[model samples]
Target: MKQQSSRTEEPHLSNVENPSRPVNSARNDVFPSSTPDNSSGESATKSSKSLWTNLKFVRLFMAYALATFGDWFDALAIQIMVAYRWGADPLIIALIPVCMAVPGILFGSVAGALADRLHKVRIMILCDGITIALTVGILFAPSPAWLLPLLALRAMMSVFHVPAQQALTRQIVAEEQLFQASSLNGFVNQCAKIAGPLLGAVVLAFFSPQICILINASARLLSGAVLWPLRRLVEKKEALVTDEHNEENQKEPETFFKQWQQGWKYLRHTHTVRNTIVFGCLGLMSILMVEYQFTTLFREIKPGNESMLGWLGSSVGAGAVFIILLLNRLPRLGYGWGLGGGYFLIGAGIAGLGWVGPDTSTAWIIMLGLCTGLGNGLFMVTMNYLLQKETSPDYVGRVFGIQNSLYSVVLVAAPLAGGAIIRSAGPSPTFQMIGLATLAIGLTGILFQRMLWSLNRRSTSSEKVGSAQQGVS
Candidate 1:
């Protein structure tokens, strides 16, 4: 007690006045203007602000949400219109996803680079405006052929918008509040998915697909207006640009091919970045196969088919909302466990779906829905959070571009593959295969967790050591 260390005495002196030194010095040490000290207790309160409360985060989320909300309505309306009017063949059905997939393959890398280079909020705003224009074009001149191209355009816009928005979200929120921001955004998206389809169906029931297109377009305009005020909140990072001292950082005027090559190089060098892309592709392919075929599969199940299918499908969204609500209270329960286990449960649920025969009860499917929804909700939110958290903020847009591109490819392939499998092997075997695949992926993820945790811990420790050295120096 008589021989106190400097560390032990520090806390007591932290509150004391030192008139010899600058009065603001203590304040400066605690909070830097550039990066807020997220370790403080107030971090939680600051991160909880909604778009109205925090216009900066609002702009980015709104950009993303509006685009997604509008596009989903358009796509669903188009699909229903095509199915009812032309009676889409398997090949035609296959073409839809392919059109959506093209932007990812063609423009994905460039979009990422642009995201790194440009103002993210502005890019998103421009994309939204373009999307609305495209919707208008589609409304006036509706054709089966235009559907794919328009979807592709939307995909391209998405390629740019997603990464920028994600990066923006991170910049606005503190590190401690990242998980909450991610979960909240994810919950809204899932809720939108549920709401969009129901709204589209109602619109279709009353008016034409063109009118639905108009409604979607209107949503975009409103989103753009909401975003206009958010320009004030965003703090643009200067990492993308070059200075006289750092000539290597100079944005070299290059050919399109060269720029594309740069994007590839950036991705190749980033270890964890590519892992997120590849995992998303493989995992989503399996999940999308189930999503695409579930409706048709449910119709063949039994008496509770209609009610159960609706409940089950909607339950996943509901589950996501539930998970979002729980995230604040249970931060210790890691998302990795939830994601891996969720995939396994989804697999089990789908496999269970195959067991529903003509005499079986539909109540089982509702339970299955709960299982699938709970797992899916957890997986989606966690995966998204991990992807953003691990990536360098400067490279977020490019990485997201690659990720979305890969995602689109899987989404395209999954439905086509599911359709083929159903036609060739029958629905039961197809469902069984999807379930087994999901279970295997989940098990593989579980096995890899220990290694991931070790790497994360080692990295964190090294970072702390580096920080201490910097402070000492």
Candidate 2:
């Protein structure tokens, strides 16, 4: 429940009296040195301008954009190659995403631990380098069997890459700039989603899938190079070394299993993090259900016109972009309301698709796409901003890693379930069911706002008590 106004403040460290407790140990401490100096009286415009002018942040942003573009580019190329070139069956093609998701579910906690132990910049650069190599292997693959495993390996690399990249953001920007930075990052990602496929489709027309793969490889290489110079910014913390004074640290250094347990424990105890993950997972499941059925829905409305699907997808991206542009001008809605209200809109938009009949115009479908996109955009930005604001820097990677794992689990199952619903109940009823379920989850957040508010209040109160005890000591 950390609001946008609190973004300028450092993470509130737990002030538990028992130094031996996991919460008070050094492994859980926020980096005091990295906290931004928000006391300056500069104008909001000036502060934003200064953040944009920072060369380091600009380079990081470019690296993120390149990496995302490559992902989407390869995604579209692979799908086309498998379907047309390899003449793969639908079930085989479906395995692609499943393979990609498996690594996150299996290795997410381990990758997060590595991010915590190693230099995050090095982790990012190494992942990108591996991606480049994987893309090359993908280009030369003779069959779907060879290609699928390579794609999964590349996805595994990303399990390490993504958490490192997100955790690194705290080091790269000031506290006040976190929301703007997340917004801009989300904007670039959305743009890549729209542009990469269009560009890939164009490339596929004139060249081979191998050439598209090569382009993706080149993008990965460029992304790694962009991140290489960020080595200086990555904090080099000592990894779980034994401390003589602190009883918790005096014991043997925490094993990987212990660290993983700590991560789960943190997530369970942190109310804001727990709620966000639960509600976010629900929203994601509903969104993916709609997305998986999109082609089927499109065929019913406009048979044999796949190109119109692209237009509708692009409309969604446009809606996201519009929200990003007006983020600063928007009212200061708290996290619960922002997330809940956004999901409500998303549910409404998805359900609206069920109403479109044979005579429904293409324009109406595009508008519905826009509605869903806007809702998703707002929900994503707000959720990311709140997670960063609430989490201690030391634990950010692990928290994000855990969230990624849970998301992967939901993603892997959602499409299969959606397919079943579509087959059994028809697409329209399936949409209505998913949308209503999502809407109900969102409504819980809105109706229980006072409960969420109390969680935040209690968090703040505990921090104050901890600070007072330290002062007295």
Residue-wise C-alpha lDDT for candidate 1, range 386-408, written one tens digit per residue = 55555544455666667766666
lDDT of candidate 2 over 325-374, digit per residue (tens): 67745545567676786787778778888777777777888898898778
Question: Poorest 10 consecutive residues of model 2 by lDDT?
Answer: 1-10
Q: Candidate 1: where are CA atoms >4 Å away?
A: 1-52, 86-90, 231-234, 238-271, 303-307, 456-473
The superposed Cα distance between candidate 1 and the true structure at residue 437, in angstroms, equals 1.8
Q: Flag regions of model 2 displaced more than 4 Å.
A: 1-49, 234-252, 453-457, 460-473
Q: Tell how far residue 367 is off in model 1, in angstroms.
A: 1.1
lDDT of 1: 0.60
